[model samples]
Target: MDSCEEGKGIRTLSTVCEAAETAGIHMVPNNPVQVLRFSEAINGNVRLLELNPEVEKSLKQGDRVVIRGLASDEAILCTESKSFEVKVVETSNTMLLCRDIQTPGKEAFTASQSAGGGLIRQEVCGSACSYLELRPCRGHLSRLAEVLSEHQYAGPETEPDNFVAGYTFRDLLDLVQGSEDELWTGLKRCKACCIDGFWRLLSADYFEQAFDRIVQSLAEKDWPIYEVPVDECCELLTDLLPRVIIEHCLTCYGKKNDNGATYCLDEELVSQFYAGYLLRRVAKFNYAEFMEVWQQTVPLGITVALEMLKGIALHDLTARPPVVWHFPANSLPYDVSPRFNALFQERTKWTLSDLRPYIEDLATPQQPLEAILLKHTRSTMDVTGQKLYNSRHPL
Candidate 1:
């Protein structure tokens, strides 16, 4: 064995090359250069390993040959069973390089762009949609209904039943804009008829003349004249006119009904000739005051009236005033009272002329006819404990 000790305590040249062959040292085919493990004894020695194949073949047995130009940490072993040993010289310059990089797919990239665009579109659409909602004028339809329901004096009803059908507030406004002349004509006739009805109710005796004057006035004003359907006009007239008369009677005399009798007059009904007489007189010069009184006092009087009518009880009249008396009497004689005579005289005098302006004034403030009817109907029911006005049965 060619044994030798090298730098850094390395041992070299052992008796058996079996271990070296098992370490994977091998020769490349068609190449004279031999590859083997690097050892410290080969340091600074280049000529032996780099020698041509001819010189390697001529090397004598037991010669001390040192390998060169190899890395210090390199190791190789023989692939074959033979104990052939060779020295490593140079290595190949090829190297492997690894790295990581990310790339987005086509679908992912498109979706990102689409999401950004959709957000912008939604914002623009929201801003534009805010102003597109509908906004209507308040009480417009209510006013139209009031005018249509009140106007009683147009010659016989001329328009089709469908004239006011399907009429919304928007439709009424459109109608007002489109045919203002027609609307105004309708309004004027309605106002005239309402005034006429109001006067007649206040004083039943003057009803005929009051109605004629209303028509004549409308004709003079060039308002289209047509007679309203009797059925349609009757209930409205009854409600409005009777209330007016009742209010006038109540204010003129602090009296209330009792057992089919006018305040002081036992033989007279409150609604008979005396109501007309009082309407003609008291409601004549002070029309506005009469209307104010009606509006304020009629509701209360209706409550009282209904109660009295509902609760009739007999009582002795030994100490009461008389039934027959002159106008403006302080008291009635013979079972009648002074207050009753005064009320009868006051309420009977109101004529159409006396009540016209108030009706006109009342008519000017437009309200939804249905809503007005509902309110008045509720009031009547509340006072009378019965439905006096039925919208379903308007007549």
Candidate 2:
């Protein structure tokens, strides 16, 4: 039985070792103990859970811990701020769970009041041949595209239809396979908002329009990209779009300035967003023509580079006149095996740089990026060029 906490903010407890260290401590005789396999003993009902120091601390401090997923789906254990994949690992040896077993080293301090005059009978409640282990994992969020895509925020005119879903934040949390922290970040990436009472994804065309308005407004006033007046932009677009949406676009593409009144646009993120918009609308684009248009798409004074498109789009330079196609990281599955297969299916052989961004999220602290690549990919290299990886097995 667990000890009960007394009333008020503080309570008292003691250890057997503390009592043993005290002066004039009386030594009691050890009780005769017997391990009995009770009639209710259920094999595999008990399991050992090993938690990391951080998780233990969080548990001791009364932080929330939840397990998410359907019975058919793989389980994800989530703390308040982090998520981990729950894995079942088998052991060769079996361990039993006994009810009312005395502490192994506290026999000498036990009272002579055993159940039957120092005769202690412990009944086995359960046994286990496996344990549960935790591995760090990115939130399983591919499902977000399905849940929020039902109602896209195209415009205020279409707002009526978009609100039909009526799914709130709690609804998303209940079904989405991510911790609270991961869920918020995923929502931001998907450009989703709690408009009215429902969660909805803002359409790409809408994002493009809002972004263009901001850029053109700055360019007309000859204002530098670094010093964006957030209040003025919000006020101007307040009627056309939600203030939250307006602010969200800015936050996605830029960070706040030190003065705290303005923001500094991140040229790379802005360019990437626009480029992704174009790629998503088309199956593929010619390499030369796409580069020329992409360069023009970004804000003035913001440089565009083919190198910056990693993880967003894949260029088939080996094609005649070359070709570029969208291969976004988000569209891929979260699990490692499927992601690797999808990557190789897109390209038979990929240079390390080209493949890293696609599968980087699958790497964990115990299983790092290099370890993952080595395990799943077959690698070969030239004399001085970058190493190339192919599928470890035939697809």
Candidate 3:
């Protein structure tokens, strides 16, 4: 009878021979070539094992294969993927700031609003979204139903109203004077007539800034007016003013339809442009995270991307004052904030206006937007000319 050691040796020999056979090489009679054990790591702890010279010889550089060590015959096959860590030496402030300010949540919130409020969260700062995702929809009706059920206002005689008793629009306006969210909340609580009136005031391009007209008309009409108050109104003004500017500029960015007079915002083109812009601007931009945020808030991909670019550009232009050109202080707009005017007081200043022409050129496609964006993506790589350029992916 064979000893236990002899049996173990026989099994080892059997495994080696089997592995050799699987690799399409036959062992010489009473002769076994040494097995060259190879552990090629694919990713993380996962590895690709090549047990014999025959197996290694059969594999193309990137070919996938099933492999087993001598211990057992069970094998795992995986495609060999090469990984490399890419490092960017010098950090650009433009890219860094872009990454910092690309607030996906904020952009999403803005999208919910723009999409006629399609998203409704119970803890949202404001009111409900509509069924059709447009204003004046059945979505508000659902909210009304909830409110009625909560108040037990079920009787036929109980008229549906948005009135907050003992609170005049003026008084409520006073209460919400400090907060944008409060203003919107108060607006939600007001009677339907008041909400409609307040909306009208905003909708009219001419009446937008005519505060006296807005207030006096609501008061005279006896419409319960809920509005952003004087202090908080400044914040709304900044938002509103930029929105108007962007809407107007967006016209220039669109393509004229076959009819020539009508314009269509080439949503895909705009998205590509925005992607480029994001890549150019945001150094540590994560595509997955950005897409996730964007999907929830504003699935209208192009519009949201355009808004993001607009918001960033407007902020950059407004925040620290212009550094591009020099202009006299006296020539600047007088009613502007003294602090803003002060940016130009001492030096010949390139104002926001000066930057407009360049922005317009870029928008119209006269300038290569991709090149500018690529410059940003390329900045992160040690090499140039489109070599493995992923800003977010390390490998």
Candidate 4:
């Protein structure tokens, strides 16, 4: 009966491994374990190791260990076994060896405090292979929030009173009661820690205050902010402003990629030119002449960059004489050139006159005033070089 029970335990452990593999779970390097390189050759019963205080403390005389990268046939051993032993040869150095055989070159050793039962099978050979299966759930989150609120203010004197989420971490450590080095590992293993931290930082009150603070700061700023009408600003401010504020804060704090709120609110709140200027200013918040040398090329750069991205570019020095899409004859990117050249070659919709049918299809209201003005003053050269008074601007 005892033999049968032992066989069942082995089968159960094998089933666990199979299930873990089926679930697409695998382990990467974990921090609690130290990876040490063999510093010297093993002679007799010992070999010297490179200095590592953490490794020395975690390992014990009777701990089970697995060494990989030594040879294909490397086997598991216990520290107290006749074959294996661990020794501290120096203050910062450790040694591992087996009797009668000298292991060649640097080898990887993993030792765990856990021994007996099915632990060796799970932790097999100190590779630290373990499944990451914890997932956030509603029950855990509610409990985590309650726990965090209770211990939100408990922090060391060195921690600032106003530090965000300060007390919550202490609460987590207390719950786990792990050593300082093990605290992070413990927290990572528990989904509650993540849930609590996320909730604490992203509470409704926190979001409200952050938004208000950002708006107030932006409102009071002295720099040219590319003003838009109040109603238009309000429409976009609620949804888009918070992200801009975060980007600005990241910049102010030197956290990087901080060009926040550089664009006008997207409903044509400000002209593209003014928006670009604001972007340049925010990118160089302190320097008045930032991008000075490159500034001269901005208009051309904008045109070229836009052309490359959209397969065409447009610019208007004056709205009175709109300069719409213009490319050299038959010149454009491969994917775009065919369609663009065909439009001109086919001549079905090349001129503004040909575009009238499409404009009419849009069901636009007839502009009597603009029609009168174009009829009275507008003039253009026709295909035969004869000037005509009825031609309107192509926009």
Candidate 5:
């Protein structure tokens, strides 16, 4: 017989590997024990042979016994006897490891209840492999009903109100496995069909299947899928905008027109151009001061400068006739104006000579900006011409 003792972190004397030794069970550590059938009644029960000699002599076959020890993966076997049964008493922190059970509608309802709002809830669906969300609105409910209504596995009612019969991760997996193109098509079609968000309603199985397909496709084409979290993905996309714009201009509008003039007629392209121009300007004007500000501001300074340049470019580009404006020539790196010198002297006790070299090092051009710009622009023009010709004639 088995008995349980409950207390606050009480240390109880018990056998360690003695039970396994008595049973003559030989097994490697960390190996899983095969359980043919689990009898709840037999849990926590210890056989008479498993007890120490002193404890066994003090108790009879029907007497209750309690022993405490650390849990392990080793299986208990009987040496003298082939098989015997023991009664259950208690259990401790136990974890079940097995393939997830197949239960349609169960998970969806559980998730819906957990989310507890009109808003959609995102969660890892089947086996926690991919994200699945729940969409709980009339439109989605209607669509779901329409799709499953004709299926043999679908329950009775076919109306939107009756669509509350949720879906299972297994069903979604089978759906994708059978017809992937149709699944993608359905997902796109259903995007606006649900108020709660269509993807949110997708079963975990479907999410995993679709995600895997996407990854395989990208990999085959030598593309990488960013394995970032959703929020991080959004952040990266935002950071990429400026760089994307720059690349687009270099590819599409970097060439000289028939009049031997390069023009940025596109509003977005012009904005990007001005942003680069401003950064260059700031660096040139007060090199040391700008560097200090840049160090302090870090990423915000870049974002702010880009936004300001974009605004200026937009205002200028919308004028009656677009005009090409030349950026002002930058002052010599070491040449401090009287205004700046007086201001610095007032703010700090440093002399102009003392600060001049540091400022020059920060902003001094190894080669003129015009020369560098000309080289880059010329290379872009050549590439654009080739691209244009290729587009016109595929061969």
Candidate 6:
């Protein structure tokens, strides 16, 4: 015990003596020593887990934490509002989980002395060689589009009994591996509406028809196409579509103005809607004809460009007549490897901007957009020197 005066193992004799002199510890051990007796049955069942500050705080607050994944998928740990990829990390140093083990405090030493003549009997309950670790990960939302597709809302006339049980908010929370906040965001992003008691996407044909009515109504009343009045649009369209569905469309297609009274249709979203409508109706359209028709299909004065269709459609210049087609990014895989395989099969090459919308969800601050491209794709340039990306591996 005296030898440990200048060593690292225990609180030094000097420290204890100093503490005694200053009355810092009420019961200063006359002899700062403890005898540890390991149990015959050494246990190794204990688990060592690590938590970040945010996770620790969430745990302290008694928030819900869950591990979610399919059998084929890598598991993720989700807190009430965030998610992290769960990993098993091996450690080099030996770590023991010893029960009844305490610092050589006077109370502990006294307890030991009273029990068995200064013998501090302790037991090693576990030894750790690995620990559970967590790294922040994106929420699992890729399947939302597909899962919600099963419950598409065509219209009120086509809708079944509203009371029928289906995948409601809680159901989706279980079915999809996302926190409530993120799942809510994903639902909104997919234009999913709560009908009766379930979540569903609006069917394309019906949505297109509803959009047509909106456009025609806007043209008839000479309402500003850019900043359409919200309440009036909903009032006029309530008979055609449910008011909730009408509001959902308004929220999806546009941003509310400063006063929140009117909603300005976002050009990109509007253009993408019409472009998707055009591309979906046809297997392929001549690149030139598609461009001309795309511009004409959108509401008057709203320009449609090839750039806006990056996420909604694909331009295949290699085919005869150099065609463009409906190859939505949402339909592709979220994982980089399979996503690239699909991309290559659809088209041989892609410019960076064209490929970004499909893969940007996988990018993080540490792994930016270019890093993913660098790892999964081989880059080159055309005759004009515009950079391009193609799959690094052959399918």
Query: Considering every candidate listed, which one attains the maximal TM-score?
Result: 6
- Candidate 5 lDDT (Cα, whole model)? 0.29
Candidate 5's displacement at residue 200, Å, is: 5.2
What is candidate 5's lDDT per residue for 130-249, written digit by digit as tens?
221211111111133244333322111222663433334334423222122333334333321121111223232332233333223333444322221223222333433222222222
**Candidate 2 local lDDT, residue 27:** 41
Compared with the true structure, model 4 gives a TM-score of 0.19
- True-structure RMSD for candidate 5: 30.2
lDDT of each: 0.28, 0.77, 0.31, 0.31, 0.29, 0.77
Q: Against the hidden reference, what TM-scores do the models get?
A: 0.16, 0.78, 0.16, 0.19, 0.13, 0.80
Worst 10 residues of 5 by lDDT: 386-395
lDDT of candidate model 1 versus the reference = 0.28
Off by over 4 Å in 2: 1-52, 87-96, 104-136, 161-166, 317-319, 382-385
lDDT score at residue 268, model 3, on the 0-100 scale: 46
What TM-score does candidate 5 get on C-alpha atoms? Answer: 0.13
* Model 4 weakest lDDT span, ten residues long: 133-142
lDDT of 3 at 128: 17
Judge candidate 1 at residue 293 and give its lDDT: 43
User: Which candidate would rank higher by TM-score, 4 or 6?
Assistant: 6
Stretches of candidate 4 above 4 Å error?
1-101, 104-203, 222-395
- For all predictions, the C-alpha RMSD in Å is 42.9, 9.0, 29.4, 25.7, 30.2, 7.1
Clashes of each: 45, 0, 8, 1, 3, 0
Between prediction 3 and prediction 6, the one with superior lDDT is: 6
Which pairs of residues collide in model 5? Answer: 23-77, 133-200, 134-200
As for TM-score, the candidate ahead, 1 or 6, is: 6
Least well predicted 10-residue stretch by lDDT in candidate 2: 8-17
Model 3 misplaced regions, further than 4 Å: 1-247, 272-283, 296-395
The global Cα lDDT (0 to 1) of model 3 is: 0.31
